[model samples]
Target: MDFMGFFTKKSSKDTAKERLQLILIHDRATVSPELLDNIKEEIMSVISKYVEIDKDELEITMTTSDEEEGNSPALVANIPIKKMLKRR
Candidate 1:
C-alpha cells in the first residue's frame, strides 16, 4: 500500500480562488468601486459640518459578492470605524 497518493493530492486552492472570483463579480455589479470613496468623503464632510470626527480613524469600505446568479442583488459592505480616546 503506497501512501504517496495521499500526499500527492492537489492542494485545495479552490476556496480562496472562488472567494476572489466572487468578489470580482460583486465589484463588477455594484456601484461601490465608482462612488464608494466619494460617498465616504461626503459622509465625512457632512458629518464634520455638524460634529467632529477623526477622519484618520474613520473607515469606509464596500463589499459585494455573488451568492447565486439572478437570485438577488450582489452587493454588500463591511465598514468599521475606531474612535480615539484622549486621556484626561
Candidate 2:
C-alpha cells in the first residue's frame, strides 16, 4: 500500500503553523491589524502613482530577521505591477 501518497492532503497542523507564524511576526513587529491595513493602503496609494498594480493581489506583512546588525523588523510587500504609467 502507498501510504505516503494516500495522505498527501494538507493537514490542520499546516494551517495552524502558518497562522501562528503570522501572529508571531505581527506581535514581534508590534503592529496591530488596523495599523497593518493602513500601511498597506498607504503603500498602494504611493505605488499606484508610479505604476499600475494589481491592488487586489497586493500583500503586505512585517518580517524580522536576526543578523549581524541585530534583529530588525522589515516591511515585506508583494505588489504585482501590471504596467508602468507614463510620465508627464
Candidate 3:
C-alpha cells in the first residue's frame, strides 16, 4: 500500500483552486503578479536560513479577514518544510 503516493499527488482540481485563488487575490489587491513572485522569493530567502524547506511547494497568498476594524487584508503563506536545520 503506497499511502504516501495518495498524499503526494496533486490533482487538477487542487491546481485549479490555487489558480483561482491567486487570480481573485490579484484582482482585489490590484497588484502585479511580479510583485507577488518577488514577495515569495524574499520570504523564502529569509525562512530558508532557519529550516530546510521544499521551495518548489511553497504557497504564498493574500486573503481578507473579518475583524473589529473591518475587513483586513492578510498575507498568508504555507511553507512546506522538509526538516528543521539547527542554527550554528
lDDT of each: 0.57, 0.87, 0.85
Error of 2 at 48 (Å): 0.4
Per-model TM-score on C-alpha atoms? 0.40, 0.76, 0.70
Residue 81, candidate 2: C-alpha displacement in angstroms:
0.4
**Model 2: per-residue Cα lDDT over 5-75, one tens digit each:** 65787689986986788889889888999999999999999989999999999998887767898877888
Cα lDDT tens digits, model 3, 36-87, are: 8999999999999999999989998887777999766678899999999899
Quick one: ranking by lDDT, best first? 2, 3, 1
> Distance (Å) between predicted and true CA of 8, model 3?
13
For model 1, residues 1-88, the per-residue Cα lDDT tens digits are 2778546645469657756766665566575555767877778776655555767767654444335554443334323334433533
Q: For each candidate, C-alpha RMSD in Å? A: 10.8, 6.6, 5.1
For this target, which candidate reaches the highest lDDT against the unseen true structure? 2
Model 2 clash count equals: 0
